[model samples]
Target: MRLRAVRISRSPLLPLFLLISTALALWPAAPSTARPASCEPSVPYESGTDGYHTFRIPAALQVPDGPLLAFAEGRRDSAADDGDIDLVLRRSLDGGCTWQPLHVVADAGEDTVGNPAPVIDPDSGDVVLVTCRTIGGATKRQVVAGAVAGSVRRVYVQRSTDDGLSWSPQRDITASVKAADWRWYAVGPGHAVALRHGPHRGRLLVPANHSAGPTARSGAHSIVSDDGGLTWRVGYLSPGGDEPLALNESTLTELPDGRVYINSRDHDRTTEGSRADAYSADGGLSLSVPFRPQPMIEGPVVQGSVLQVRGLTGDEPLLYSGPSDPGERFRMRVRASGDGGLSWRPVWTVSEDRAGYSDLVQTGGGTVGLLYETGQRTYHDTIRFTRLPWVWRLLPELTVSQGEVSGSAR
Candidate 1:
């Protein structure tokens, strides 16, 4: 077959379109740091959904990398502290927009494992977690009273090298870290801090609480690891027994000046009833000042979380999350401090509904991530993760359910 060839002048629009396409291809894309607008508060774990009766005591740590490692206690049988409870973890690589499947950190077949206190070693980049293992289902009161005969609380350490993807076997360090005379001990239900500014910089400090004997009061203390979590020792023990306030479920933060600041839950409900605090300059080996009541804040003797918002220092801009209600365990509120912790201003009410234990961690892009227990009808029904940005300071108070909840977990 014969064919004819035809030629014509290229249109000016063709060159313009080519130029635009080339420019578009060469231009660098903007990083998607902004959370999805459709994201809403979501329950990562819920009771009766995961075969566990309930979940409680949240602890989250933003690893040296960009992901968040959230730890919780999965009660296999019931919501009570005793029984087949497991220390479980869920990871979020996208600043807590979504979380990975539940990963069991340490599971004792018939015993209980809980109170996850995690700290990242800045030098070695290891996520070290310390948890208490009770041989039998025993409540803190029972343990403190020495009623659970032949059953005792012990401490174990687990390390995650790949940013919390997996954890090592639990290493028993109770003998070195706990006093043999002590009857009950629990690690932080919140994230632990590492010293960065003081002479003891790079030290890993795990905030903890313990009772001396069967009838003794509980006080706050910290476990310290200097050589990147290879070994741990009892660092500082707060003075004054448990008279003024029974310190329990404590949280820690390293000040810019190198002093370790402790925020504790006070069990004494009569006179000096408030959150307790103390400071230590010796890298937690000893509290230079004893723990005292924090009169400015009030709660129903619940575990709280304290975190230093990234890039904001000098004691100002510290963030605290807990149940703000004095008489009830409702209203999960986030308060901001302008003068270290002397005074606080409510930034947002995470949930005006039923709420319980909570944890706070600053994301890679500087937004705050909170993992807490809240439910539609009860406090222990579900555990949700919420992201709060700095802009919340200007807008009217917002709750997690009102804000966007992203389901995209990468």
Candidate 2:
């Protein structure tokens, strides 16, 4: 898509048009140059192009320095799940216009490390990344069933003090966050949010998923840090039930009442294409409302993202991104909500072709940035970054013409 340049009139004296016409006749009009294009995408990672066979599970965060850091899993062998996977990142200083070279944040020889969940601390201006790792040979199915020999899934935390230019060594936090019965665990495949209002103003909440069952299934949860990234503790884990009741891979947004609104991926076949949502009142210690479907959001049980854009005084409109079609992962679209997340309206369609697993964030300039997985055929073909205009730019334009405009065109 091409972006049209905006035209602006610099002359303020419209009534003095006769006087300005004398000067305009002497000085020819200056040549017009196009403003930089918007909504253009840059590929941060592509399979087979960067030595890795695949790059999946993207997470993005814009640090205080104004550079966007995009995280993904670099799979070395093939598009399959279990392999020599490492956590990698790409940096973009000028919104999403250009990208820096690949930077591997965490690599463990032939081991698997992925699912980057990053949150920036408002007070300290530091960024923390929480991820999961496992042995190279172990698959998620084997880990979920507890068929593996020893502890399979482990959690780790790392920090970046210099605006994602460098990172500290990984520290294991499995014992503090994971239960003994849980086998399959994963941090968010998206970015986490920090609270800005009410009692839990500075709390950092990271959305996550785990599997702990007599029947062995998956459920969604959160891990939070109050005193910054120095420490972390377990929050709430969703209660599991019969078939079509399992929830996983969640995204979070802070409500006006200091509660967290979670939108989760449903694993049960009964619900099929819909997502389940819940709320945490006690700062994610437990759920105030259990997981249930909202008819407004129709997704194919895939991971989606929610972002709360803050206004000058308080919470503003909330944004959500996912596939518009309930049956397939196509028509990647974004929606907006005025009353938190109760109702939604389609803001824009990011892509009509194949797309999956997107994370959204408001950039420093107030424009929205989307880092997601998209391709022509498969989901893991490439990781891309897309920028969107603010709400004012998307308002409907009223044009008067001699011919009647159809309602469908409007």
Candidate 3:
């Protein structure tokens, strides 16, 4: 069977771009990054504290020097993925030290609406959120296998013009983004990216994953919009079959040199690590480099977040937040790569608790904000936000694979 694939851009400068990227990717990480002494996290949503059974899949987005908006799936009666879930949000006027009250951005009344992958349209400073909507009766696995009854899986979007104070209602965009044969679809369980450079500059990208019928093998793609969020299209579809790239819960960031770097969860876990990465030079419209396992950056089978943060002294490092412990979903570690998405070294571990899915957003200056699922018992108990100082760079000093001490910094 023929597989859906992206049309690779044939720019004359493509070879030069690949050469630069390859050098950066292979360059050894410097062992000189400094981590903060402690990450005093602020709980934005505690399970059962806000009349909800749980809060999971945290996604945070903020424009430059703007208010920090934190988003999550508020499960009403249970912690299960398929249930009465609403896309809830909170705002932080100051970095991330404090947060405002909870607000339900989109609620489909007893149905599920989540996976809030929010992005800012830099031209108008508008916040656009993309989420997946489905019936509460059907599980993700059931939907993937094409055995769903009521609304299997759909896509909805909302825009906030007043800095997250109110949304402009949920508008369905499933028809344009999802293909005919696609069985299961999901938008980012985290934040999206707005391109600032490259030929497709000003385009907004949402990295997503979907499954097909007959076999239900998962595949990753990019949902793109060129004219703000007014219109959408399927940008690229990663080639399927026997590549060990059954990516799920994908996240992306625009590199310093105007490229899209996508990191995804290996749902099938066919490789050694639970994560794989690729590069898209043509703004996420296609992958310049296909997905491959990144063994240096370790994590469990969980949703992770990545962002390109600006350092205080002109450095632009790509920061990734995920569980450092490959054995279990604990030791939420923050890592950084000075040369785009080439190499990574630890900045510091958030905690040794049962931490799992996490998302990262730059909170201005040299500090970064993290919204993650962590608890004393299970990762779904509560979702909290913390700040990390991004002062220095890193070159792998040690390679201790036990836990948090995966040594890039300390």
Candidate 4:
């Protein structure tokens, strides 16, 4: 699938220029030398029920003890009730080469559970997992069927101190929202990221979007907790405006310079296009108006994730992965950004022939690892991994360096 280009009006360039200038001025200065390649490939882990299908959605989190945790949703069949959706998790201890057995972190009984987002809190050093659950089935008649089936959706939080070995009881974080809107369908948290530095260091910021009720318009909201995940303050990114143009699967990345950037699916794009980008000056408390779209190699879809490479050259390349469809076929492709997200270069294809979500992490040895779903014609999508050397993109530059520098210089 090909991403359509967004029109850039000459009027907005001045403000954008000033914003970029201010951001750069506040950024910490670093050595003029470019970052060395730090990503390498490793083996992937795979696991799931034999017959029932599973899909790894959103992004995956890398914990301290070497295990990578991914939140996956499973489906018995398409005919099954929508309320049957459940959240399952898998881990890869030895990089991504192999995976552990399926662990049902949250399951749908009379309620629905999906959209699992995992993050490792630096302050507590614990892995926190959040997912949205709907109490009632999602059908026209179900809304009129009964109070139980038409209940609202909510966001639940769980933490794992010892990697993915165990988890705390699910805690509710949707009490501040409207009761009916917080029902099973539209109420709940989306993706979250912890502050890496500064006074609010270690606090968690979760992006909650509107998904409850039939007539609700989706907007971006956030919850902040000063004491790790113990307490939260809820508010909207853009107060009293049409919900900021965004969808469910969004990502937050803290740059080396201390600014937090958010990339979200642009549901407001009327024509075909790729994802949209936003920024948070006050550590995700609020976001600027959505920026113009970037040209993505893949066509537009609702969910994707983007991560900033800590030590990369040419504008700190960002890795983005999401579903790309061209007509009837669906595939997953990864793209690289040289000048941030203003432009992109195609990197690799995670899945050339399947339907799933993917996550990327920079390993200790400077390799980039990807966790995604595999298995065609099967309902259960097992986690698959692939590693690429950090030097993959730098190979061309290295070749020139070898010709210019002598052995004594090395």
Candidate 5:
């Protein structure tokens, strides 16, 4: 796949400083050094060739080996080709202290590989990688001037039996199902979560979307596979509302009470650009009509990720990490929830510098690992990693089990 250089226009709501300031005022003040740990940000070692650069997005996973596996989209300098945006993987073995190198997992054959969502299947211990592939580059014209291009963009899934070392052949998901229009790009197998401890246990649920095309409405869709992504059944969620609620980049977690909660990115919401909340039940297959949005400390509207942390004392707490757009600058925020997703307590700031499109994973030792783009700008940025103590972002209800130490050095 060739890499295409499309200049994505800045969001119309680019001046977000006032919005961020207002949101910050609503947020609770930072506590006076409560839970401390080694809090040093490490620069990610860039992998891949010089000509081929990879930009990390909001997709990553953590394995028991202490390495945080991340997927990035690689591309060349030119904007003519979209096929060069291949999917590559990297690992941070020393607990996000340092990263190894980039491992090319999947390369798009004359297509663009993007929106990688990685998850670890508890039952099989296999790393499941799902990404979107654009066969001809549907949105290239939107990026480039006077360029009329179209492609068959479909989501594909690959499994790695040996952690991030090897992967199986890519399988196209929407092969049988007919799309609404040829100009429509159906991307994202967003975040795949294997149901744990419930009637839907062992099932893998993937959220996808068909962007607005020449003929169809852009809305959210979901696919479920009982047998670990080999076969899937497509379905719609929260459809036929007053306005189009295009849900994408969803994060799913099974609560301790056997309830499945999905926090999705709402593109067409009224207030929040990045809206999140819980779905009805049954892994988003049967969702409640007109889902309500959760009240997050407002910032720039961008995609985020969530993880359920099992405390040392067997307490299950939730952690959410995302880029908070403050109008002018973007920062990463970490929030905690003790009672599911109903309420949240603000935690430490993940990135003091500019950041965008973040993903989070809870390490086996209870540490939270973050993969996010760190730079002043949005698309063209560097991916950085950082780890915080499980209690770094403390909630009033939860106790700090581990001692806090300042990891000030990178």
Candidate 6:
């Protein structure tokens, strides 16, 4: 291609300047980094169509260079939290455009077995899932009030070696993950995280919550496994004595600075919205940033999910998925955090219809997949999977005082 020249006032170095500028202008521009992606929302679990009465607590996970997995609680009887609930999953091999048939991951006869917090092992390439087991009809009120026995509210583990095509049998890990003093226990209703950096890389960290005896104080903690899914142990646990922060139903995300950030749903905190956040520097074994309320991260008193994505540049941007409605469970939105989890700004709204629990996973090629509960009649009517492109910044930046979310883990 011939280079075009621009004339200027006669100067001493005019010839050289024109030659350089013309040559540089003739150079081709860098290739565009834009990645075009789109997918229509597909229902993976319809309440009345499946054998189960209702499916809730959506969890989305994708194996590295493999298929995507969507998990939920298959309530056998009704949409209630209890009564013959099972952990179910659906696999997607075509970038979540379509899904396979439903498969039951864990079923406990007439008991309730749900809270599918799944994570893919970075070392073994296996999909590990942690779940909470409870009696069929046991309510959280009764269990936290110390009326229900601890044996009912237990924890279990299961894994899939063939990319979620088949899962191993449920192995009870309550003794390794749960405490004897706790009455009520629940694993993550969202996706768990496996560490990918630092010395704790390949560690599977599962966020959980429990209410202790006597006071029935609620606290958030992590159940960690180092040898893939072989052995498990309890990690950093927060105190819930008389304080306004009654954190539960937590989510985990690993930051670029090798720290684990946790955000939980607050039931006892009346101020600073209904969400609390903390950080762990020791690979989720202990807290480093402590638990504090996020006044800017506003939402309803429901479970929210946090995910760390590296496709965006500049900083370690994170994505949060939950209902945006401050008063009710409606209008599901995905917020963006430019600086880890310290601050967040609304980016995308997955749906404005009635919605509830949601899980977020970056499938690949700068695309994020969301599996959430949404329906015309109610949020529990069905579960759908949707994929959206990472459009980077979509709104103004929002931040909060660092002093508010700064303290000890205890």
For all predictions, the C-alpha RMSD in Å is 12.7, 8.8, 11.0, 10.5, 10.6, 10.8
| Backbone clashes (count) for model 4 | 29
lDDT of each candidate versus the true structure:
0.75, 0.75, 0.78, 0.55, 0.60, 0.79
**TM-score, predicted candidate 3 vs. hidden true structure:** 0.85
What is the clash count for each candidate, in the order shown? 9, 0, 5, 29, 18, 0
Tens-digit lDDT track of model 5 for 107-136:
866467877877677777888777777665
User: Candidate 1 — which residues are off by over 4 angstroms?
Assistant: 1-38, 149-151, 312-316, 392-410
- For model 5, the stretches where C-alpha displacement exceeds 4 angstroms are 1-40, 45-50, 78-83, 140-151, 176-191, 212-217, 288-290, 377-380, 397-410
TM-score of each: 0.84, 0.84, 0.85, 0.73, 0.77, 0.86
lDDT of 3 by residue, 1-410 (tens): 22222121335544334432333354434223323344346788898867789899999887666788989999999999887998899898765667899999998888888999999998888998899998656777778766674247899888988899999989988889988788888988899988987578789999998887577788899999998999999987875566666788989998877888899999878888888999998899888899988887887888899988755445657788998888788888888787787788876666778998889987654467789999998887888887653322322322222232212222
Across 163-210, the per-residue lDDT of candidate 1 in tens digits comes to 988889999988888887787888998888888875788988999888
Instruction: State model 6's lDDT.
Output: 0.79
Using lDDT as the measure, what is the rank order of every candidate, best first?
A: 6, 3, 2, 1, 5, 4
| TM-score leader | 6
Q: Best-fitting candidate, measured by lDDT?
A: 6
Clashes of 3: 5
- Please tell me which model should have the higher TM-score, number 3 or number 4: 3
Candidate 2 accuracy as TM-score: 0.84
Score candidate 1 by lDDT.
Answer: 0.75
lDDT of 4 by residue, 300-340 (tens): 45466677766544355666766566432246566776565
Sort every candidate by TM-score, greatest first. Answer: 6, 3, 1, 2, 5, 4
The true-versus-predicted C-alpha distance at residue 256 of model 6, in Å, is 0.5
